[model samples]
Target chain A: MKTDQEGAVRSDALLSSWKQTPTRQAIVDYVDRALQEGGAEYVPPSERVAVFDNDGTLWCEKPMPPELGFILQRLAEMAEQDPSLRTRQPWQAARDKDYAWLGDVITKHYHGDDSDVRVLMGGILQAFAGMSVDAYAEIADRFLRTTPHPTLGRQLWRCTYLPMVELLRYLEANGFTTYIASGGDRDFMRPVTEELYGIPAERIIGTTAGLRYQDDDTGGSVVYQAEMEVFDDGPTKPVRIWSRVGRRPVVAGGNSNGDIQMLRYAGQPSRPGLRLLVLHDDEEREFNYTAGAETSLEQARAQDWTVVSIKNDWATVFADEV
Target chain B: MKTDQEGAVRSDALLSSWKQTPTRQAIVDYVDRALQEGGAEYVPPSERVAVFDNDGTLWCEKPMPPELGFILQRLAEMAEQDPSLRTRQPWQAARDKDYAWLGDVITKHYHGDDSDVRVLMGGILQAFAGMSVDAYAEIADRFLRTTPHPTLGRQLWRCTYLPMVELLRYLEANGFTTYIASGGDRDFMRPVTEELYGIPAERIIGTTAGLRYQDDDTGGSVVYQAEMEVFDDGPTKPVRIWSRVGRRPVVAGGNSNGDIQMLRYAGQPSRPGLRLLVLHDDEEREFNYTAGAETSLEQARAQDWTVVSIKNDWATVFADEV
Candidate 1:
């Protein structure tokens, strides 16, 4: 019910950080219609749940997801202690800088059988076992602070899309509870999500591992166990959302095939919902290849979901340096 | 930084619904100390996480938890179709109204080994498999609307402690994000948590079951799978809190040994936190037996955690009738 000085509902100011375009205007109109009292599309505040895919939708994922960099750094550190790690599929891929092997692992896990995916996930978990949550978070934080994106030439954390950040705040101003349903590691994302997207740790759902509480000779702490708990991607995304959030989302956004199931789930037949896909076609400002997201773009066009062209919709991709 | 017309911080109005007591005063003082600008105990709003046990801490659990009632009803309905259920351990106990057998099952599972606990939880998950989330919620809602507490003679939902409800709102008013960490079924609690405690489905963390999304001959819907996802109780309480919330709670309240680990976790050595135990000692208003909570009471005294006596701390147990 909040209004700006001009007496317009505050959600109207959404996407002000973006270039004025039909896509931005469409989104603002959709939000306004859903929030207006007595309107046909008006949704109760409690049911106005919005979900966003974190990697490419909110921040840069090209030149690899920042978590992959963190993982590679972790693998290198582990390989130093255990020479056996240098020969493993994921570890060898990281050590030898084998993009083809890494890409194959990721693609196979996404489109392969359940057991193969579990094996890949299990390997990732085993590498992180015995690590305390605080220690793991410190590793991620250090990587964010020191590492610059290979292509963007900026600190990885600073590469978030400014327009998407505005969209998040705008939805919240209209009483929507926004959540991040990413395919990244849940623990790794939690340490920086609040700082980056104004989303709390509890509001972020992603791949998780089993944790064990231990009190031993050293001290009392909870340590991550080497077991995949939830794989939050593709079909699992909708299932995890149903289990964790309970409410079906009214708005969903993503930029890849990994998010197709979640987007479809949010667009329930009985409800009025918004589904958006961000197309990474702006090579000048941001990396512009859709190497793994071709199917997502095709689906967006076929289903009439809004597709935001990064070059056309966003005027700025990052905050100006102070 | 919210204040009343008299310029006093607003959380002072927190437990106004309850009779003023030393315990209430102590709680208010603790919260205020943690919120003061430059106080040693000052905690930022983002880190102000509070957790509450649902059963005895917020509502009546004596004469058995209300969920048991719903479970029994469900068992009876299932028995009508499958008579073999009447011969099973849990189903037979519910069908025959054998409290002793049910009590033994609960106690044994709590004190038993990991495999024993898993078997018990697995049985529970099997009973609820194939049930849609919406359908399950409707069943819980219907039971709540008609069923009455055996001793209080009020609708089951009406048996919630008014004082604790006030406390939950008070914490929220002061920027605390409150969560219900219960041993009850997550799906069962979600149906009524919003109405009973002002907590949404997402904030209620409890024992969960695996879910599968299937597009069958009928239609596409998410169904409960026959698997124990997380048995959130005792040691698992703190573990689940770390996994789900990703922040250690600043305050935790419970009423039984099932909550001991969570209480201890909240009372970390390095942080300023509050741990509260609710003791049922008001026979006239509600049940007054601590049959299973003696260890919790002993720990409360040993650890200097605040203990709330239902007889002394609350002026009213339930809301006034219309």
Candidate 2:
């Protein structure tokens, strides 16, 4: 792969060279097999769809999912500027960088107090409204360029898993429309998925805040948040997939327990399908743990799901790992 | 314009010719003038969307909106198959084409005991679901091929008001995405909209039912019904438009009172905008009416919105008429 003046590896060629590796070859083979013999004998062309979890599965999640941090930072900024935000749990936790408290805030925002997620989404959207779709893309690009993972110290976008990217391309080349079923915010992911990955904004399904349209002072339109929407992880992933995409994916993948329901939905017992779980077991190369971890891996084994050891199954993790 | 063997005129050349017309030229000049001296500028592209009521504004709505008839036929079929359907108040009235009962049934459906529009949408979707999106397109194409307005005896697709079609094309050409926000059932219009009007299914917002993803007898993915959703007409038009599209349109058009809210949403007093109402007053060329004995004209007058007389503003009502 060619290196630019900044010594950052080019994704365009790393993505192309993925086919040369046995690990990438395995993913491509499985994807091809799923496409050729996955559906019923007389299945129509439109029914083939494969969904992948973006973070951990497609990219590195060690530093934090880009959107979660971006949002947390924005929350703090908004609180510092508005002062009223500190009164709210989420905004208060965000301002303090209290990650644990932030989780509780998100939980409360979604599940507690008879709250509507739309209202939370409205707040999230209001923070970033009036920004053009192109402006969002530029922000994502700038962040990816300068920001490095806290652990790996590699450019965040380059942390995209090599093998899984191959699998995505293989599935797409075979007529499977790939969608990112991420745990990240839908609005945040939408701005950059098409540029970072091949997935379009329209097809990315994830956790979202409720948004409302607001007229700006300059007479422009913006989608502002009124509240938070459902956090599309765990069991809700499957339900949101059904609600949004209106179809069950033939193949699905995830790196941890957060994706079990999505994987289950993809590998529905009634259908012919393929499901994969990525086991982060590369301590020297990446983070590895079973217990007391952000992504619980031990539970995945109990479900009889095939766990791919990133240390063994992948020839590489991030492009800049060298 | 290319005429198919079945005597149906295509939209391609007709759209091209209409753009060059004096009425379309005037609209272009008006928008250009607005943009140049003190024209409105959209900060975000999403707000540039324009929604039009399809039946009366884009084409003829005579002999009642075609979709109302389509739903009536579907309701009759449902009642015939399940005699229990006849016991349902609205279904019984709809099955017998009881016009008087329609207002009460609809009013009750919206304001009375049964507020779920999903029940109605389920019946509509059930009538058409399992048919591939392709098969539905074919049926819609055939309908547009042979069916003509009762008064005009001209293919309904070709009966579009030339000025309005040109207006739609002009907006689209200027990078504004146009949508059909009709009070008609969303499912009924989707089948033929893309072929006849060039609007995509996702962009069409109308009355709809609740749908669920389920396995068919052969274990294939399918959209099944749970209940009826909102009917996209009257007050619900603006609400559904806001709910679905998430942006207030910069431009809106309609020919009846059902479109009043939609027009108002677009022509909000604070924003620089335009909202045009097409008044069908060409009796010799098209059916002329301001207030019908059983229509919503009084509400239209009360709103004090722009009223475009077809005989004067429109140089031609239909391609053949011109």
Candidate 3:
């Protein structure tokens, strides 16, 4: 509500929850310039589309993504219910908490044949495919409430980056239609996205499986199928964005090479756009390993994107209560 | 800007552009009751989702869908450039404006193997594959500006229903997030949806083709592919709605059997919902044929849904200027 020297409302106050750093300043300046009524870069409120990558950009993805942890836990529960699942490949690995095997599977997913990844993803999806969406949401909610982060010793949902939460609010206040474009399962993210980041389920675009519609003695419901519909990673990110959002985003934020295509799509030469990369370099507050982020970091430097170093730029990482 | 009897702001003034009829009154009352603070049926702003079927609900689709017309025109243009295309089955049918062949193709699409439909859609998509989204949008805009409705003697874009336009604005003013869920091509609708309706491109969901991302000497762009990713009709409508919108709509409006599943999805037994069917029974203002909509009308009566009679309920169909 504060006004500037020319009696225009200043936007920096909206980001008071964010630390005063070069990275935050750049975002405020860019938003201000883009919102100025008569400025060359001024984009109308309707056209202010901003997309953010979920896992590493908005929340902690250090030891592993929280969804992976949930999937493993769910697999273990299923194994306990059905003893036969304990003998299965992916379920056995998950039940035993075999990080090496899981890591090998993930590596094979990225470098080796896609069938390996498909097997893992397919098994995970098949585990809970027949449940109603409401029931699945309840399971996610229960997991989020009871499970603690491996290293942070807090609830998994509470481990979200405080600065990014404030950034989402700040952009929304400036009339930017924000969306979460993630590689995570769409249903998995929907249960907590609104509560955590003020993003509704519809505003979330993610990897998905096909769904089947049914109306029998149990009444009508849509059931999730084990079939993978859209992978929604790397180049497919931009394609899904185009398919669902139908507009090229004016701003994009990410922290991995999986988001390179989305970032490049947002930062097109024909229009003014902003690309932000969040760097995890604070070992004290968060993890500091960048094993898979080398290409992303190189591209950020080469393209002169706004790089937010957690150690230097964030006054806080997780909320105090969290 | 007007106030009601209790000195509270009333949103009905926003719909003054609409006709004063029982159908309009029903919608206004329903919205007002649902939005009342202490009402039993009160819905939060974030959960106020309203979805509409585009082709027949929002605009005129008499002789055929306007997109079909546009596709035929494009096919004829291609036939001129490539002489060999004149002998191609789908292309030749479109080029010659052979209604019998086109009707057979459409009937086969609905009843025959999916691959038959795929062949037709693939050809239509391939006709414009590799074109940049912006360039394709320009082509849609040019076609919309130049082409007139065969019977109406006005531009196709000008043939939209006025009452429905007011309803879209009214719902939006009441904090409902409006989405157009159509069976039309996704890319074809994006160019004109924003200008025609207040809804933005991101809120529009429809059938889509695959896209490819490439960065060559001419800079970076996403190109359309000759692939049919989703055929959003009938049962597929609800599936796509669940896939993209995530939330089931509280209000749904449509005009044909293709929208039956979507309307049923919206009118779930667990929640308070509205299902509206626009009956094309007006011979003077619009077409009077219900060749394919008999099932929808019967379902509307059986389900006790709101049946909007165009002849009796609408004071105006299209704008006077149009």
Candidate 4:
């Protein structure tokens, strides 16, 4: 139960005696009205779907995305194992700790210039395959347990916005189904989501790799491939969502222009939906430079998407339990 | 360990004893020689993928494909629940038990003459969504367990060819990966393959309706939709398998011309691979007239693919253990 303050429930005070932020309250109020009082005008409980971007929105994307860390680890391992990898342009740059060339390599990979995408994906497959599904889950658990934010020095799991986690729980408590519609690798995320977020692998839709299944023939074991699939980024987010999940989400959460189409897709007046864009307005506690940060937050505001100011909306940025 | 009459250890005789078929032995011997003696010059393990068409090639396709049965069950349920569905052309034909017209309606749906494909698939989604993934697996299991052949009066599971099953195991034992690249719906096949044939959901590539993952707030479960997607029939088989699996299968098994493109893609001398076409030469045990069948097998033979005679090569068809 939530304490009613004005026309909306004070989200912060509901579970604890924390102050309720305006933007969080406003979003909560809108959802409550839509689900309860909006009636036939709004989508029914059955159709009430909410999709959320993982990084930057639900969690931090500051120094680097989580996947970049995985990439960095792989690059370091390869450099140590194969001396020739140190001589390779991008690998050499990474070995020298010069990350300026990373963007160029990524661009080349996307444009089909540097190396065969299949071959590159083969590396991922070889690394991940043959390991049990449980082994991967354990790795994710360990990563989340040990890794802390460089700036805040808070555990990465603790770095998840307190209000947003509540929002997901609140939506679930109500008749709203929530999903982490991320741009990360589907396999990478699947291993951790169920434990961290209570979201199952079936519900967590994301970028995937092409996989081949083969029977190990011991008892019932099967081997799977981990080749890179269609990257779910920018405008391709909505397109990939439609292909993989096959329905327009009723509500969507995003942080930057990368999520514009996803928000827009949810914002269509024809479908009863809600879209929220998280704006990084807190600079004291977190690195905040809206419209100018490397992640393209400017174009999102230009589109007139509903922006939630973190400085004003969130009373506590990270979880108190940790 | 298996011993031959000459006191030599036979590589495949372990699986061969369980299978006990002349056709199975022939396939094992051929593939074994190609991999061992032929070396890298002949069959590389990377190119040792074997794809089998599900319906007739692997299981019984007599009355109809299993997916069609599932679809028909869904259609009947929808027609009964929604009276308006009876007024629709295909539904009306289905309600009246006009299977000939139903076939025509299905053809129109696939060939793009009728809008029934979308509506029918929507009906399937509504019918199956919210059903637990476990329950769906049970439905497939029950169908395989209880459903008997129309003419043979034996269970449909018993209709699975012993030789083919052994061949699948033999291929996997040796470095070959097997896949069911079929014209059947992909999700529909997912529930049954692992239990029946040792293939996992990740490896089974087939026709699919577009599935949407929704957090069903009402039921607290993820729901999948069975909406029409790019159907894996005729020429689409090869393209879908490559795109979905991202690997060209080296050895392909298909019983009809619907599988021609897949077989051609696998068997091309342009690449190093083997294609085996299963000829339905057994009229006494199963329907033998492939020329007049829904899938024209004669057209496949014209491609000069190696034809496996079901009647001549096999000492046994189905397992008597059941």
Give DockQ per model, in order. Answer: 0.47, 0.12, 0.53, 0.03
Q: Where does the lowest 10-residue lDDT sum fall in candidate 1 chain B?
A: B1-10
Report every candidate's CA lDDT. Answer: 0.79, 0.60, 0.79, 0.61
Ranking by TM-score: 3, 1, 2, 4
lDDT of 4 by residue, B1-322 (tens): 2212221134446354333355454465556555663344256655677889987788867656666666666677678889999887556655676667655545574344646655655566666765644356567667667766667667776778777787787777777788888877666677667767888665677765443323322212223444454567666776556544434677888877677667666734434556677777788866674542234355445544556677776667777855
Off by over 4 Å in 3: A1-12, A16-20, A36-40, A107-115, A216-219, B1-22, B37-40, B103-119, B217-219
Which model, 2 or 4, shows the larger DockQ?
2
Q: Looking at the true structure's interface, with contacts defined as alpha carbon pairs within 8 Å between chains A and B, what fraction does model 4 recover?
A: 0.00
What level of docking quality does candidate 4 show?
Answer: incorrect
* lDDT tens digits by residue: candidate 2, A55-157: 7788876645666667666778889999888878567767887776544444453333325334444456667765543355556556666666666767665
- Backbone clash pairs for candidate 3 read none
Candidate 3 CA-lDDT value: 0.79
lDDT of 3 at A275: 88
Clashing pairs in 1: none
Q: Which residue ranges in model 4 land beyond 4 Å of their true spot? A: A1-22, A37-40, A103-135, A219-226, A291-304, B1-206, B209-322
The alpha-carbon deviation from the true structure for residue B176 of candidate 4, after best TM-score superposition, in angstroms, is 32
- By TM-score, how accurate is candidate 3? 0.93
Worst 10 residues of 3 chain A by lDDT: A1-10
Ranked by lDDT from best down, the candidates are 1, 3, 4, 2
| Candidate 3 structure quality by residue, lDDT tens digits, A1-322 | 2212221143455555557888887888778777777676777777788999998899898687888888898888888888999989678988999888777665555443576677688678878787777677788778876778988878887989988888888788888888999888788888889989999888899988778777553225777777778788888888887777777888999888788788878845545788898889998989886665678788888887888898988888888776
Better of 2 and 3 by TM-score: 3
